[model samples]
Target: MLETRIKTRSDLKGLLMDAQDLFRDATTATGSKADELRNRGLNLLDAAIEKAQDAQSAAVSTSKEFAQSAGEYVRENPWKAVAIVTSAALLASLLARRRD
Candidate 1:
């Protein structure tokens, strides 16, 4: 899943770079060539936006699943969850203080 997200981000980055190049080309182009370059750039940007939306949707779904599982665990073992959270909070605060 992480690898997929990373790859998606990488792909999006490349698409954005290509779109930028197209737009730059359009700026220096004339007549039909300029219009074609602009259109291609717009299409690339649209594709990148769609891919980003898909990745975001997947991340939100995964986060909701994790939250649901965590909630179930906490309900099943209330005291254990409290202890774990307390320990984590204490450790985080201690580490933060040390950093300060």
Candidate 2:
């Protein structure tokens, strides 16, 4: 689902870029054709903004769910959580020392 959202956002971004280019090109035209291109560009821009907002909402929801699940796990296994953190810290310190 996340991958799909990412792809969708990428597609929308590409489309938005295309729309902007079209709009810029429209500036070189005269009268009705220019108006049409500008209108089309605005429509595409609006759609891209809407989809971007939707992706952001989904990401926030997914993060909240993961955070909630992690909280539950830590509550259920406090000692194990502490052990994991300690081990991770030790590993990080060792890796950092190696870089020096």
Candidate 3:
């Protein structure tokens, strides 16, 4: 009877060791998956930042071209440009006052 009890206890210890090893393997797998997800998120954010920078550069270039064209037009037609600008300013002030 004593021998049988000792065998049973040893079996239980072996089973416990197997369960611990399985748990450790699962934990390692989960940690690796989490790290992969974190890296993917960072990559997506970097791509978005690069896209935004490109868009900002394009907008600045377009604005500069528009300013140059408007300046040339005003130089060519000074009176007409002055009248258009005054009317626009008056309309804008009226709209601002109404909003306030």
Candidate 4:
């Protein structure tokens, strides 16, 4: 039932927010519980943020690698790449004319 109350990400976020507020204002028994929950939630949030940054970094690195490789390929076969693109554009234009 308690876990069901936090069935979604938004619900968990609300819980974390409440815990933070309690920890901020607590001076009673609730303070200890609030502190524990707040710390755990903060840890989870920090770990998630770290993993996301790592994934983003990896994606950017991969994209740069792909772009560099593609550039090298184009440089190594400039005329062939140009002819292929030109042929595709010509075919597209011809098809569009027929459609009109």
Best by TM-score: 1
Estimate the lDDT of model 4. Answer: 0.68
What TM-score, over all chains together, does every model reach? Answer: 0.92, 0.91, 0.59, 0.58
On residues 1-100, what C-alpha lDDT tens digit does candidate 2 reach at each position? Answer: 8687879878797978989898898989889999989988988888888888888898899999999999999999999999999999999999999999
Error of 4 at 75 (Å): 0.7
What ranking of all candidate models by lDDT puts the best one first?
Answer: 1, 2, 4, 3
Off by over 4 Å in 1: none
Task: Show model 3 residue runs off by greater than 4 Å.
Answer: 1-29, 93-100
Whole-model alpha-carbon lDDT for candidate 3: 0.68
Our model 3 lands, by Cα RMSD against the true structure, at 25.0
Q: How far does residue 19 in candidate 3 sit from its true spot (Å)?
A: 36
In model 2, the clashing pairs are none
Give a tens-digit lDDT track for model 4, residues 3-96: 4333444445665576566556544437568677567757766655665565567667878999999899899999988998999999999999
Indicate which candidate wins on lDDT.
1
lDDT of 3 by residue, 1-100 (tens): 4564465456555545555555555556667775665555555455545655655676678789999999999999999999999999999999999998
> What TM-score number comes out for model 4?
0.58
Better by lDDT, candidate 4 or 1: 1
Clashing pairs in 1: none
